[model samples]
Target: MPGTVKKDVVVGLDIGTSGIAVAVLNRSSVAIQEPLGFGFCSSMIMEKGFIGDSEAAAYNVKKALDEALTAAGVPFTTAYVNVDGPELVIRHGSVKQAITRRQVVDARDLIKLQQHLCETVLPEDVLSIIQLDNIRFYIDGEYVFKPQGCRGRELGLSSTVLAAPRRQMDLIWQCLRNAGLPPTTETVVGALAVAQGVLSGVERKLGVICVDLGAGMTKVVFINHNMLYKLSIFPAGAGNITADLAVGLHTTLEAAEKVKKEYGLGLIAGDVHVPNISGSGYNTVPGSLVHKIIKSRIEEILDFVKEFIEELDLGASLPGGIVLTGGGALLNGLTEVAQEYWLMPVRIGFNSLPGEEAPNEDAYRYTTAIGLASWGTGQVYPGMRQKAEKGFKGRIKSWFR
Candidate 1:
């Protein structure tokens, strides 16, 4: 077998419902300057957020990847991608080991604990664990960040596990294979990737929420103490808002989408001119009516988010507030509307690159994809980069087997 060459460049591919976003980043660059190039293509073959046709999805994925890589003047084979919606499953599990002998714990022990968690049995064969994230290690009932040198008689690992149902994994893998790429070292949950790219370290510790509104689904991510504490997917997103507008105003889906983008949260102070709805289908729907529709649906989604947070009993405690990303976040006035409903500080999430140069006006749309690339470059230690599952922490594999 040929040894894997260490990559100075990495790519993040977000196969989202509304579109597929690809971002190329330099592994050697500072965190803010890593963006090399990025691209997004509408996901025509993804039906309601799942891959309806593997061939079509792969083709689109390849096209997006090539577009970004070519623009950046970089080359790549395997890249990390995001997974969510139908194939997405999250659960909480804690695994503990008795040291038996009170001895110093080492890197080997931590790696073994993670592997043991991953290799542990699941409820069914259809599901496979991808990440044992947000792990907090404790030695002899005391929480510790660096447990490798600690002496302890007992060790515990607690984390939120990300798993994929077989079909979801297959669709994404097939797309990678058809793209002529190597098998991924591992996959990232879409919302988890978004958090990595958008939320700052301080925000994560202060507690925060990320609402990734894609065309097919809305991924709600809650973070506290710099880890993904909880996540859930709502079946509808900005696409559904477009659909509702189409039905309510008797306009075409395309026109409704345009209007939604142009005047989202439609809370403008004056009468707004409706474009694209002229001639036969022309009917002037008041700007207020449009905002009303958008606000209602958005509020409903916010309500669900509120309910979820309330369940965790941290709704009132998130000083960092909510960060909204994804293509849907581009909608005008969305941040204002979100703040109104959540009663917390709200901001549209955008990645900070090294310089003032903006890749595109809609850079926020690629938040998750940028994260995938950042993560590919070792934002997450080991990050499925090792050839062996048991590879030591900080050991970078030259290539994936």
Candidate 2:
């Protein structure tokens, strides 16, 4: 296929565990001309983050990409994609250096500084190092944001590193290639993408946590100073809830999922009353039993999330509170449960792009995919030119290397 670069068109594909979503956007402006196109596929979860059915996954990805590109009236040549799941790993580190009076620093100096920092840490594999804002430069014992052109005696660099298993990344790249699309520029969770799309600048600056309750994974990310401080993904998700319902209700998986969509809630709004099924005798299970089953599964998922947050030692760090997004975020009373568990203010997040028609109130289910596109457009085109440069090269090397 010939490479085509439409000045305004960029595509973002999210290959998730339960389904695949594709979005094509106009990068020059904020308007999303077409909403994302979605394709459903079965995710063969072999392990926490490992996907086993590459052929099936490729088909789903291609279908979504085709529909999205066709809707946007663009053909794929170069596009951004977001990858998520358990394979990726992240860590934070810092480095302190003394600056000489009247010293000049260049790009190489920055690279060397990064290399020196990299040397101190043991990375299972170094995928990318994101330089967080607020590089603290100490000039005569005071911290400053920028020290260039200033007589600084010391510099302190604090940064977060995002890495992933080499083998897992390779599999995703190969899958995308097989589907006739370029590999993703960066692999970020659906949760962080949703956080970027929904959280405000002030909220991020003040420290906020975003929880994305996806189908196969639930991700928690804490952002402060416009950078991620912590992120955790659990294998438990809406799928597990549905599975629990299926087992408890003794119904087919499809039927259980349907029931979950129709009447699912974190907390029962009223008494659980089972409607009579056509083929089965009048449902005998008490409403409280059904409610218990659902609530128990959701609580288990939340418990895992709580444990992860505690592990990160961020209970005291985020003052802006927590924002929830993704399909699972819409569960009735989820915010209340999350607030009680995390002991923070909780709000549900949705896509709010300028000039785009407000999504259906329930469309929070697609938050991650929409946010992936939004983040890709903002980061790849207008926002972080340096980061995009780094991402583009990093993605290429990750695939081929």
Candidate 3:
């Protein structure tokens, strides 16, 4: 592979239940990126992260690409795809290597160990492996991050693999191809991407859970020590809230969606006079009613987040607390709701980008897509040098040093 240069551009494509987002970034180095263009297109082809209609999904993908490419004034290349964890079948695998002598562990040693781990036997139900990231490396039975040049008698590798049903993966590829997009580098979970873009190194080390409240599904991602710890997706999402408001308020889905955003915070903030909503059914209804509806659904979604947190006993011990991202995170007063539920510090995600309004406003909704672009463009995040290095010179330097 060639090295990333000043003009090397990457695209992140986030295919969500309610819409598709595209983010284009110009990579400067291992950690620096500048936004070129961003495009967001709404579609009804996806239902809770699953593609309900393949043809419509493909067309929507193209429209999103066109929007982004035209804005950036650049041609298409391979994109990084953001597929939430629920769409994948999760598995844990580990491998061990015996070191007869206490010698310096080099990059090749780590690579071989990872290759062994990749040989993990999959269940017959698995279709294909989407992506394998992060590893709990060990030398002489002690956990380590960069294992190179360590004098140890044994090497070990442990990691989580995200795989998907073959048909589902195929449909995604077909949609991309039909959209005239290039091949994808790897599949990334949207929550994980959001975490990378939102949480800092110290925050991850302290402990943090990033929940992406997307339209179709709510995704939970746990981060610690600057590595991906766990990821999961739930069936409930902000869309459920919209549906609830639509039914409870006796309004059209569009009207309910508008009302939800306008009055979603309820009395938690204050009342807003929505003139668009009329008739006896809504004219006298206080914003509290709308808040009541939104709160009920949001509480249920937070409960789902609680289930995953319990998996690792992340209930009350997380010092870095919880960070919210994704389109669903845009709802007013959502952070307050999350804080009340967890009894922990909660905040909405914003771009880590410096000195600019996130290369565009409304960056909160596009956090996952931006993170995906970093992966698709092979641009390393601030602390992922070990995973991004490649090529003969890079290899020789590692071995010789």
Candidate 4:
């Protein structure tokens, strides 16, 4: 192990169903790109979005962290992690408080309102809140971005809360602890993290839909006015497509994954030679059949997303359209299929450093990890405040911290 860097260091860890990604960031100057390293390890210890095997997940987490730290030549023991899955619960609630003491809405009123929301609106079951978004304040009935110092008798607040089962969250924390890395209070939703890494501030402000196509799940997030407006998770992803290919072509899962990476196209194209499941010979299959199988699964997944989006009725509001990210986004012609399916402009999400013209091929897969690092460094949007500061002292300390 190398000596840890003395500079301000931030780490981001994303434990996904198909793999674990680790990103180490060292901020020494204006541009913080030259000293960090990105590491990844293939893993199946996670089922959907929760850890299925704590021991195995811990081992893989250590392996990925070591790889990144070794490359960065620095050791770290803490990281901002990402959480998502079908078991996640999303709730929207509002609370109002009467400012009778001083007849004014101040930091105290805001804190009280937030406390009330958390204590009363959330599910009574054991759950860990991973994200608090879309926090808004109002004076009377009019919305206000900043509610402090207002002469109002009543203060109201509303927020979108995301929580995961406490038992599953404990398992994730144990895995990190066993991996020699202690988890922090900073946890981000997987979809929001991807949006942070790939979608520019302008895009978010103008409105955009970010679809993260992971291995076992796909997350759909709608951002407007630079705030996370909605989030939805589905059980289908690129892994489902690979499974379909394996069964349709009579091939092994491994072979199907290989074929998918090597020759999978979103549209019908040239023929493909798929290996047999018996590991004996190869079979020549028409590209159209392969595309049919792949497209069917892809369409099904996106159909759910489409229905969700249509329910939101965001017609013509999202000028930024939709951005596709995750390992599944790497599938060739994915943007094309998504565009045709949604009848809107779509592009692959890629992370790029300042002054860089093009991003590398693997950038999309690590987008969430990168975003987690950004959050650790406090590069957060104004509207994405995690929670209300306790008091004036706490708010002041946070501003300088």
Candidate 3 local lDDT, residue 91: 73
Q: What tens digits encode model 1's per-residue C-alpha lDDT throughout 238-335?
A: 88899888877777788888888888875666654444444364667778888888888888788887777787787367888898887778878888
* lDDT of prediction 3: 0.70
Q: What lDDT score goes with residue 76 in model 4?
A: 61
- Name the runs in model 3 displaced over 4 angstroms: 1-5, 29-31, 85-87, 97-116, 119-121, 136-155, 268-288, 352-361, 376-401
- Candidate 4 residue pairs in backbone clash: none
TM-scores for all predictions: 0.82, 0.75, 0.79, 0.82
Evaluate model 1: give its lDDT.
Answer: 0.73
* RMSD per model, one decimal: 5.4, 5.8, 7.0, 5.8
User: lDDT score of model 4?
Assistant: 0.76
Candidate 2 lDDT over residue span 1-401, tens digit each? 47644346556566766666666666554444444343333345334555577776677777767766665665544455565666566656677666653555333334444555544442444354322222333445566554455655555555554555655666666677778875334555555677877888899898887877877788888788887777777878887888787777766677677767766664445544343434464355665666787788888888887786787787466678878777777777778878888787888877654224324653453456666666655441233223332433343234445
Cα RMSD for candidate 4?
5.8
lDDT of 3 by residue, 252-288 (tens): 6887888878766647445434333344344335567
Instruction: Quantify all predictions' global Cα lDDT against the true fold.
Output: 0.73, 0.61, 0.70, 0.76
After superposition, the stretches of candidate 2 with alpha carbons farther than 4 Å from their true spots are: 1-6, 30-47, 75-78, 95-120, 125-157, 266-283, 308-319, 354-362, 377-397
Candidate 4: tens digits of C-alpha lDDT, residues 1-401: 48644565677889998899888777544664433787888888888777988999999998988888887777664477898988888888998888766787766577667767766667455776666677788888789867778888788888887778877777877787788774233577888888888998889999899999888999999998988778889998999999999998888898889878875565557777878888899978888888788878888988998997898898756799899888898888778878988988998887764112213666655678888877655442322333442222221112223
Segments of candidate 4 deviating more than 4 angstroms: 1-6, 32-35, 75-78, 96-113, 136-157, 183-185, 266-271, 353-359, 379-401
